[model samples]
Target: MKNLIYLLFVVFFSTSTLNAQDFSDIDKSPMDVTIIRNENHSPMARVIYSRPSKNDREIFGSLVPYGEIWRTGANEATEVTIYNDMTVMGQNIPSGTYTLYTIPNKTEWTIILNKKVHVWGTANNYDPDKDLMRIKAPARTAAAPIEEFSMAFQPITNGANLLMGWDNTYVEIPFKNVE
Candidate 1:
């Protein structure tokens, strides 16, 4: 009887541990990171954001709305870390991590880099006073619709253009390294 009880306890504890170790379901909007390197292949800047799928719904103007500030991605506010000083749209931005925000319009989008970080969804937490710089980037229609929101760095002669697209709209923010 003692041996049987001990065996049962072991099985119960093992089962409980296994269940506890199980992971939860994947996030609906998964996190993604995109990094850009300099001429020597050294990291220049990185963007950490969550990609939310279109799911057959209207993204811009309807779901996201126009002339309103967007967190630039889902879940936590999108973060941009610059390893060195860079010029965005001819405006100088120092090396640091900043929250990326955008105001999308049909003609163009206002790209904002804010000093705030570690913020959740932008409900009442966004403060305009913390903004470091704001630049306008023209919005263009992509040939194909992107199912998921995406960001990529397109290499240029001096630096790289940070491309962002979702649904059918796309925008590019140019970043030039300052020597």
Candidate 2:
């Protein structure tokens, strides 16, 4: 009787502790997103983009600052790997990966293009001159927190539009198909 009670107690306590641990990333993660494109140029163009939800303790500022280069998001900079040339904001961007940054404020934020791609955000190897484009867009407030950062393309007449919105902000960058 004593041995049976002790065994059950140990098993139940251990199971409860393990279950208490936060398994937040079990179903949802930053890597999960809908990659939309209008790649008719043959091999299919690709662009990688990400939005962050909780940064450290705070949402935007603490994890992602107002005036600093964020690795786009937590862990590493958010990456957008492109397989071909595309025009954004009326400028031609060649086939390569680029790190997307934003200057966030109450109303508007400017999107950035740094030539260096596939690196951690805030790695400090960025050059402003290599920036292919900068386009300003409006940020909209949301009633609730967006648990996941997301990026997707909306089809347009001339090209595919990269629409980004999360945590009360939105931006659109048009990627014109390279012809």
Candidate 3:
């Protein structure tokens, strides 16, 4: 009886230790997902990205330089999934997954949809030859400053507008469902 009890205690402790896991610290720029659904609640579009905080520092034209391609988010490249055929900026886009890249400018932003997916940040990984679509969206000053990077969908008569805001700048990209 004593031997059995000792063996049981040893097994329990060993198993408990073996089950212990070491996880990394929380990310500074946390991952986020925004999805736009149809009237029937079926998902139409989705964006997965990391939100980096402003941290009271200059964001545009400084931290994220202008006239250059940005990964569109922190850490990994932003992923956009389209569930149906849509028209953006008068250009047609089929249902598929793509990496979202952008070029920030004071007056407008050039939105890019690339064929590549699952890429890390845009450190020499972005290829213009692989670009599926490029559209220009006007940038405007926000009513209030945003502390963190954000992406959301606003419903419209045609389809939905993908609104991106960071710091004091915001831009809207419309996605119209193709009949």
Candidate 4:
């Protein structure tokens, strides 16, 4: 009787634990990050962003392939808000919320901003007509993978560069700071 009770208890506990486990979205988790640029704007200009690492799992020709449209992140297409208008890659970009995306390759990357906002990745589909602007930048190789993907708006001499990277492929879209 004692042995049977113990066995039943273990089975019940195991089943309950198993049933309570969450397995959804385990394959794609995003790295949460907040990027800010406050140099020439008001008190601490900021933008929220996120990206998942394109690490060990073959980012080059798989996952995020070489020469394919990547939403620049796993979730809501990595949104950003420039408090003041800036010039990116020598092109004028207005201040507002925009969806960020990228086309990656071994040599270069095209950074893009679509007029649309608040959408689940590239699922909603991007229309080139809706593009606010696109900037082409070259990719620089790092000695190693970044482990975790990261995005940050760093203040440059007269602008800011939106930096992105994972697994040695690093790139930046220089946004000429606007006063």
| Clash totals in order | 0, 4, 0, 3
In model 1, which runs have C-alpha deviations exceeding 4 angstroms?
1-24
Q: Across residues 23-132, which tens digit of lDDT does each residue of candidate 2 receive?
A: 77553335544454554544334555444554324555545556565454444556665666777777777877777777765566678887766666565756677777
The digit string of per-residue lDDT tens for model 3 on 107-126 reads 99999999999999999889
> Which scores better on TM-score, 2 or 4?
4
Residue 162 shift from truth in candidate 1, angstroms? 0.1
Best by TM-score: 1
In candidate 4, what are the lDDT values of residues 1-179, reduced to their tens digit? 99999999999999999999998956465546655546544622344555566545777568888888787868667777776787776787878888787899889998888888777778647667888987789999977768767777677687666778887788977767666
Q: TM-score of the candidate numbered 2?
A: 0.67
- RMSD of every prediction: 2.5, 5.9, 2.9, 5.4
Could you tell me the TM-score of candidate 3?
Answer: 0.87
lDDT of 1 by residue, 72-158 (tens): 989999999999999998899999999999999998999999999999868997899999999999999999999999999999978
Deviation (Å) of 131 in candidate 1: 0.6
| Per-prediction TM-score to the true structure, in the order listed | 0.88, 0.67, 0.87, 0.77
